[model samples]
Target: MTVKYLICGAGPTGLGAANRLMELGENSFLVLEREAYAGGLSASFTDANGFTWDVGGHVLFSHYPYFDALLADLLGDDVLTHQRVSRVRIAGGWVPYPFQNNIRHLPPEERWECVRELLPGRRPEITPANFREWFEVVFGKGIARLFMAPYNFKVWATPPELMDFRWIGERVSVVGLEQVLKNIILARDDVAWGPNNTFHFPLHGGTGEIFRRLAARLGDRVRYGDGLARLDAEKRRATTQSGEVIEYETLLSTMPLDLMVTDVLSEAPNAVREAAKSLAHNSVHVCGVGVAGLRPDPTCWMYFPEADCPFYRVTNFHNYSPNNVARPGEQMGFMAEVSSSPHKPVDKAAVMKHTVQGLVNTTLMRPGEAEKAVTAWQMDVEHGYPVPTLGRDAALAVIQPWLASHAVFSRGRFGGWKYEVGNMDHSVMQGVEWAERMLLGKPETTYGA
Candidate 1:
């Protein structure tokens, strides 16, 4: 069948496009999803123990009013609001997030060192060539060495020198020297920094609940289990793995742009294919542990900068919602995220074991508690984070325009390959804007081709 709009990968982006198309009174679109269910990486799974876990740590927060209105209409009162209480484990102590702003939590010697470097005429004046240089220039040697440098390496799985700082706007917290000194002198914790300072989660189905309800609304328009096998840009046709050919006037793909160019579009230009290669990403290993006892603290999530833990961050999943645990108030759960890439290799077979030990080492669990803790679930997402490498923009410059020339719009986290605007809200809005652009000739402000 020929479709007016063929949406690829029923994640937030595709769902947003399909939903907008329906809102515009258009019924000729179809959404194809490879997974058995919708939500893609945003999907959730209930383990054998009846504990619900998401693909990773997904929090609901929005920068768009339209997205806010849509979520309110969809979820209504069935959501749990949370004030983010996050921390970073560094220098053998717990410091409130935005570690640079709360140096008072550090040891006296460490705190003094931080202040010493921030003093007048202590910082070096140099143009930053990369993220590492930017860190050292903006945050002095002390904060950079103590937390920023090491913590970022664990998260990105790539050297800071290899990444670009363009994606760091509002994502990373930057504090002035005077404020740091005043906070250190007064012993104040500036924890709330980013857009996710306050977020929401579903009361029952995990992060995937939002997408599931969206798919239900889309109904037959969203087809599951029919993965795209190949695409002929010249013919505007897509072949599925199940031998179904779908012809479309325009293709809106939310799949990873790298995969679309390398695997799906066989006739893509060699230069475009090579540009896709320049896109870098890290794989994520999510380890969910169910503990018998209640949580020891009220922390929503904690970041580990030290090498003592295999995981970079651990979210108290049970704290997100009572429904996350099989027995609310009686059982607890921890969702740990570990990133791996060519720079950092992880042993998939030993990730669970290492995660258990990491919980103990990081004091999230007691020494003997490892034996009692149950491995509720584990997942390795091949395309976890789209890294903002130095060459990413230049590569996207080549890839996006070439695809657009063929009536294709690649939009999403991995689709656009821009981590700066790759959050859930941004991803969904990309699709919403894409549909508006296609149907009404409106400019896509979220992501420009």
Candidate 2:
């Protein structure tokens, strides 16, 4: 079969392209997804015990008005708006998030140390070479050592020194020295800072519901279980695992670009393959625990920087929406995210045990409460986070342009290999922009295309 546009991966990017094509009154496109469902990493699932858990801690907050309109139209009254209540577990106490702004909660000595570092005119004047230096320069040594360094290490699963700071826009909270001093002096908390401070979520079916609805709207254009097995860029043909061959005028791939170049394209250039090796990413392990009692706190999520916990972040899934639990207002749910890479390997088999212990260690659960908590679900996503390593931009500079020359647009979280534009809204908009560029001659501003 021949198609005008043969899109790979039915995740947000692919769906975005397909949706835009339909909007333009075109039906010459096809979306192929390996999974039986859509949503990619944004997907969600319900456990055998009836508690719902996302792939990780996914919350809906968009920077684009188009995405906001699309979601508003799709979800309508089924959306639940939430005010983010996040905290950090540190020094045996809970500090309001943006840890730098809440030094008043730290011990006397530590608080004094942080204040002393933040005192007038201590800022570094040199340019930061990497994320580590950026953290120390942006936040003083006390806050960097206390939270930023270890916490970021746990999340990225790579040394801060090896990653780039360009992708830190809005993702990391930066505060002025005066604001820090004021908060410390007044003993006040500054918990609200960041785009996701107010977000929305589906009232039911977890985060995956949005994509599931999108795929449903697209109808038969999206073919699940038909994943790309091989591609012949010269012939403009793709072979699926089921042995069906397809020819396309142009291909838009949302698969991991590394796998696309090295594994799928048998004749990819050696330089592109070598550049793919320089890209770094971490795998994520999600563990969901269902407790028999109501939620203990109203907090949405908590971060852990200490070694006592195996996971970096934990989300109170039950609090995101009441319908997330099998028995609303009765049973509660918690989901923890653990990141692993070559530098930080994780034993998958022991993840459950370690996660349960981590819950107790971080005081999310009591020792006796372990008996009342059931392991609802556990999942390992091989490409959880696309790291912004020091060499990432240089590598993408080599890979993306080459693929574009081959009539392939690799765009998405892992496909584009840009963590700054890796959010759900960004991923979908990348697809829309790619389709617009292909069908309407529009230039993409999000990915700098």
Candidate 3:
């Protein structure tokens, strides 16, 4: 088959591009999805016991108006608005989210330690180069040692010394000593810290319902269960796993940039392949445990930085929407995310066992609640977070030019290899912007800029 635009993967990016291309009156585009279903990582699944689980903790918030309008149109009355209630487990107690901004909640000794170091010239005098140094400089050693260093290691599974700090953007809650002290002295709780302080979620069907409805609108333009296996970039031809070959003028790939360069494309230049090798990423293991009876905590999610918990963060999945549970308010679901890389290897076989026990250790569940677990669901994603290693930007510079030269544009979380703009909103707009760049000669803004 021949087409004007060929999109690989039916994830948010691919769907966004195809939707925009069609809205722009271009019907010559086709989307290929490897899975029989859509939504990629955003997809939700129902276990044998009927509890719905997402690949990981995903909350809906937007940085783009186009995305906001699109979501409103797609979900309408099916969506539920939420005020984020998140907390962190530290120093053997619960501190509000944005741990630095609310250190007053900490025990007297630790709170004084955090305030004392930030009082004067206790921080390093040298300019910061990496994430570890950046946080230590901005937040002094006490806060960095307590929260930043350990929590980041758990989440990224890469040493902060190896990561660049530019990706911090708004993803991190940056606070100064003055404001930190003010909050502490005033007994204020700084809970609303990030863009997701106010967010939305589908009323039912977990976070994937938005995409499920979106795929319905695109109709047969999307061909599911078939995705690119190999690409002959020079010939503008792609071979699918089903043995069908497609010829296209423009290719937009949502696959991981590394795999796109080394595995599927197959004939990339040695420099590009070597560059792909330098790119780093971590895997995520999400374990959901559904227990009988209601959970008293109203927290949407909680972070774990100490060794007591195997997971970095856990979500009150049932709070996002009661429909997430089989019996709504009668049952509760805890979805926890554990990240892994070569630097931090996880025993996958023991993930669920560890996750449940961790839930008890962290006080998210009572010891007796483990026995009350009606269902436990787990999903492991090989490429979870795109690590912003020190060499990431330089590696992307090498790989992107090669792809551009071959008329293959890769843009998404993994496609762009940029964590700064890898949220659900950013991932979708990366696709839309790519479409605008192709059809209207507009420079891409989300990923390109």
Candidate 4:
């Protein structure tokens, strides 16, 4: 009954790591979950009328081969591969996503302005110091003015200039002047430009289903309702809220990196605690609105860049799959995803009313139609999606290697804190790779890259 690894946090990253351990034919690990169930931010909730809501918009995209293989293994025939049809709503126009790829979607005058600005084409040769400068270089002034500037502001909840551009690999679409002009003239759709051009979803269950299957595979190795309240690192033991002490030979923490180092590593490591404290995170507020009518469209998710609405994005949750909410001839649901800042406090009353108002104003939901057809309303708050600022590397520079020395490897959406590789696939590999490194001394991609 002795465990080899004690993992904290039952989020996708935690479960993913546990799954890798199981796959290695080694079950000497006990996963500690603060929550009663699996799927940290990816988990869903059910309201009175069987309405379902994810923490926010949980889309699956993968960059690693092992992640794809494992998801296929877990979902088997239940996986529903989808072509991404995401779009952005800009000042009453429907433009193809990655606005850079579809500059032709803009009006003639706007397009002319973009081209004119590029003609001067100094194409500044300076290295991009931040996200704003980087965006301007890739998309030029006109397109940046229309979408990139405002859209990114809403999503990041910070001035883009404050964001570091190092996270930009293939995640951000970069187009040349010729490519932009060609896309405009051709009006071609390049929606599937990133790593998740065609992604998979569980047919019957929500995103949480993937973890449920992973947890099922782990069986007794996974513990629910067993919250890890404290860690006795020197003794290689973790104490739960109920005063139970579980010992392990090695620890792979998938919890947020700061919490893991500060709360779990109790040996008073020098400068580590301070570095953890220096790290910053942004919290997210997810609102789910379930309607009693057919969906407006089969679109999976829509991005809102205009400031008329408080929410930045809205997902046609029911369109992801019929089983995502209720069955056919059952009911329909919609989710509005809003992000807030620590500097800007969220007023629930105003947000709720404004969310409804914004939905109507944007014509996403018809006036009074909402009142008649509305079935239920729910909101989920997850300190979800970490912010990648310039100071991050400096902080991780001090924290990451320190934890490794203690046999604790932290990786995940916020665990290793790289937004680029923090999706379901990436988080799971964080665990698997961490375990592989522990077992076989393999290089850890979660922390390394």
Cα lDDT listed for each candidate: 0.90, 0.90, 0.92, 0.76
User: Lowest-scoring 10 consecutive residues by lDDT in candidate 1?
Assistant: 368-377
Give lDDT tens digits, candidate 4, residues 1-449: 35788888888878877777777777777888877888887887766667677788887778788877878888899877788888788757777777777767777787776776566454455678898888777667776787788887777777788888888787788777887777766867667688766777777677888877777777777778877778776677778877798888877777787777777666656688888887766666777776666854757788888888888899888877777665554566778877777644567656767777778878888888667645546464645667788888888888887776666667888788888777777777777788787778798765583
lDDT of 1 at 286: 95
List TM-score per model, in order. Answer: 0.98, 0.98, 0.99, 0.93
Candidate 1 lands at a TM-score of 0.98
- Model 2 per-residue lDDT tens digits across residues 156-202: 99999999998988888888678877887887899889999999999
Among these predictions, the greatest lDDT belongs to 3
Sort order, TM-score high to low = 3, 1, 2, 4
Clashes of 4: 2
After the best TM-score superposition of candidate 4, give how far the Cα of residue 275 lies from its true spot, in angstroms. 1.7
Q: What clash pairs does model 3 have?
A: none
| Cα-based lDDT at residue 41, candidate 4 | 78
On lDDT, who's better, 2 or 3?
3
Question: How does model 4 fare in lDDT?
Answer: 0.76
Clashes of each: 0, 0, 0, 2
By lDDT, the candidates rank as 3, 1, 2, 4
Compute the lDDT for candidate 3. Answer: 0.92
